[model samples]
Target: MTCREASEYLQELMDTTLAPDLERRLRAHLDTCSACAGELTLQREIRRRVAAGVPRQEVPSALRQKVREILAPREKWAWGFLPRPVIRWGMAVAALVLISLIPLTLLQQNREERIASIVIEAVNDHRSFAMRVNLPTLPTADREQVRELVEAKVGFQIVPPMGQRGELRLVGGDVTYFLDRKVACILYGKGSKLVTLLVLRDEGIEATEQGFRQVNGLRVYTATYKGTGVVLWKQDNLLYSLVSELPQEELLGVAKEMAKI
Candidate 1:
């Protein structure tokens, strides 16, 4: 190998990709040329330092706040509402993945996008409702009256599955919407565990063989968003979802029990 050839092969040598004959020739040239050997050593050192995974310098808190203020309009639509930094990244990615992935053709044929949309919304509501029960002042209801309140206010009759599990109790239920679809937000809890069940008109929300599992002969769509478990299934003309921090299998059981209603 000439000096020029050795220079050209330096990257491949560092990458361990040179052929036997060419690599032997390059090594022979490098052994005789002090300048080429030094260059190869320098390249190896550079590669080693880059592959070391150096820590990044975080921006100062004050500078970050200033940048956020300057970018508030865009950031508000992005991450401003998500209170904790820990949940922010996961939520943003999940939310973005569903939106950016669905093409027009897939939107017509599949329910994956719809599942993700509901899961994200359900988890958001689950977190908020868990913090503070969003009890409506006008049409309030206790455990016994939650079903009646949901029927009257939400324009749908739902058997709130408070009786499905021993550790579950009815907390609240309210009328909400996603796009133009009226949604029934049924909140339940037992001890410290929280569960939010959303009932909406079915919009082709079916469980595909790949992303869903059959539970008690029902196609159940179970997903984990952030650390929360989301179980979505359709019964009759309405779609149902149970969102909580409970184990997904438990959620599936609860969903299956709710489907029986």
Candidate 2:
């Protein structure tokens, strides 16, 4: 699909309303086109922010009255002056959709926002390493010692997978706050590319198997949030979200290996 075609399907892709075949084609386009992928990521973030930050309230009577007045026999219909009963029926359906849709749309958006947020934040935090790479960090040559040092600072022991990541060398790590909860970010690198592993206490909302999949027989949640790949899994009281810009197969390969331990 060309960029133009992909753009048309993007909203449906976000809404999951596209046919499976079309969705696959658009996804293929996104995988190879960084510009479109970035566009999608931008749109998704905006949608999520609106869903999560907006306040919800019941429809006010004044607003209802205003709507009623507006819908009350506006002007000539394109089908040449519709009958009163026909107009009233149209108004009733429109009003039903408008008045009842608010809460339902809000509920759906709230759930989508919550689940989408499970990994988008990790994607963002990983992206931030570009700017923060120059910041001082504990040496990551020794994973065990690095983990301990991070625990000392963050007051939480993070168990990063002791599995082969091919050429990904541990760059460095730091402690930070996400949603007011203390967390650890361990950076790994191969050449100039990077991957981030975030460890934080489970806040309970992420338990749902929203983007769930099995990696090496272990259940892991995966998503393509913010134009990057993320894999999430929980062990004990802690949750692990691995974020990278790699293809899903490569990303999941590392994650499955990490899940082995």
Candidate 3:
């Protein structure tokens, strides 16, 4: 979809009401276009700030009566042919949906806030490698040495995936802890694009409702967090989350390929 069309549907996209095909194209466009990504981020931030500033108050009975009176004539004209009971039921369902959105929106905000912090930490750690901070335990391409180092540090046997060996070369790896559990944060590079593959135990991590998808017997969670695309999944008892600037589809393709190893 063109950028103009994308802008037109941005509200629906935020509400998660767009058709699946359209939503896919929109996300694809956002992935490669930094300008659009920034615009989306700005819009979301504005919404969050506005929501935070807004006061929460129950609708007054007089105001509700006025709104119903204003819509009564239009509803009567629009649904003149429909049965009264059917119209009443339709209005009830619409009210139910409106009422439920309040809590659902809050729940979504909390989930995104929590996940965003984790994603930001991962992204920052990925960037820290360039600064030569918290250097990897093993720097060679020897699989045996890397595996031994990872296992010894994290207490879990890990076979770091060889990502496009030459194109996306694995530079080195080190162990890090998340929520007290061992995590093997492996670093890989492809020209300017740096990828960090996190391997850890999935004991307490919760899969997001909208972010969860399945691929080749694995449960995948995909999200664009803090301007970075993250692909997370579980294999056996191990959880893996890959963080990068790659598009969602491209990231998923790379992830699936890596899972083969």
Candidate 4:
């Protein structure tokens, strides 16, 4: 399997949900890739912590007392109505099964909530940054020159759109953090319009065609964001969003151009 496919299935492998053949493929990849191996180790640690930390519920005192009473012997004639030993054993087994399911159900709920929290935190951070910054000044040089300067100074390779001559004019940019991940936000302008392009390590969101999502009135576009006549695409696992009060069509045109790049 390819590295990307292996990476995608790593979580399933950790959860022991993958079919044996697929699991073997992923394991083989992990054995060779140090990065994937480290990721697997971290995932295993997280699973262990989650399992260890989730508190198991104890049987309620009232229920325990009731069970004891039911199991106790009685000399009264009414005892003749009691269940046979086999029926009693079946009921006990059913009760145990039901009780055992409670913890697993709670654990599933907790795991889902934890994942949701992480995604929400990432989206919120993006939204918060959008609200705080001002647009930067337009670049004085050509797009290629600006890209070269950015690469030299910022250490990130910036590729401009195809068939476009300096469509996005570089403005100021900043480095920021969200949820322990470092991010770089570059301000750019197309003509008189201004926008923000964020280069993040990763937002932890799955890649999909439904890339644009709005959170708390902040319009976030993943892989690409368009504003005015400029489009931005995320390159190198970094997220890029053009935050501008521009027309959607123009933004889409810019996105198409960037996709070629």
Give per-candidate clash totals. Answer: 0, 0, 0, 0
Q: lDDT of each model, Cα atoms only?
A: 0.76, 0.77, 0.76, 0.56
What is candidate 3's CA lDDT for residue 234? 71
- What tens digits encode model 1's per-residue C-alpha lDDT throughout 1-261? 689989999999888899999999999998899999999989899888988868788999999999888987555565556667657777799978887876644657545666677788888877877767655322333755767766777676776765455666766777677734778888777567987888987754543334777778887788889899998777777888889898877777777777774
**Model 2, span 1-261: residue lDDT tens:** 999999988899999999999998999999999999999999999999999999999899999988887897554347547788987898899999898897776456654465566577788788878557445267466678668768888777775554474666777777767754777888887567678888888765553566566667767888886678888877777778888888888877777777645
Cα deviation of 135 in candidate 3 (Å)?
A: 3.1
TM-score each candidate: 0.55, 0.52, 0.51, 0.35
Q: Model 2 reaches what TM-score against the true structure?
A: 0.52
Worst 10 residues of 4 by lDDT: 222-231
| Candidate 3 residue-wise lDDT, 1-261, digit = tens | 677887877888888899999999999999888888888888999998998999999999999989998978576586689998998999999999988896776456565454555566676776666567767777766766767778888877789887554467777877876644788888777677777888887654554434576766556777775677888777767777898887777778778878864
Regions of model 3 farther than 4 Å from truth: 1-117, 164-166, 206-210, 215-218
- Give the range where candidate 1 is weakest over 10 consecutive residues by summed lDDT: 135-144
Candidate 2: which stretches are off by over 4 Å? 1-112, 131-136
Error of 2 at 17 (Å): 65
The alpha-carbon root-mean-square deviation between model 4 and the true structure, to one decimal in Å, is: 23.3
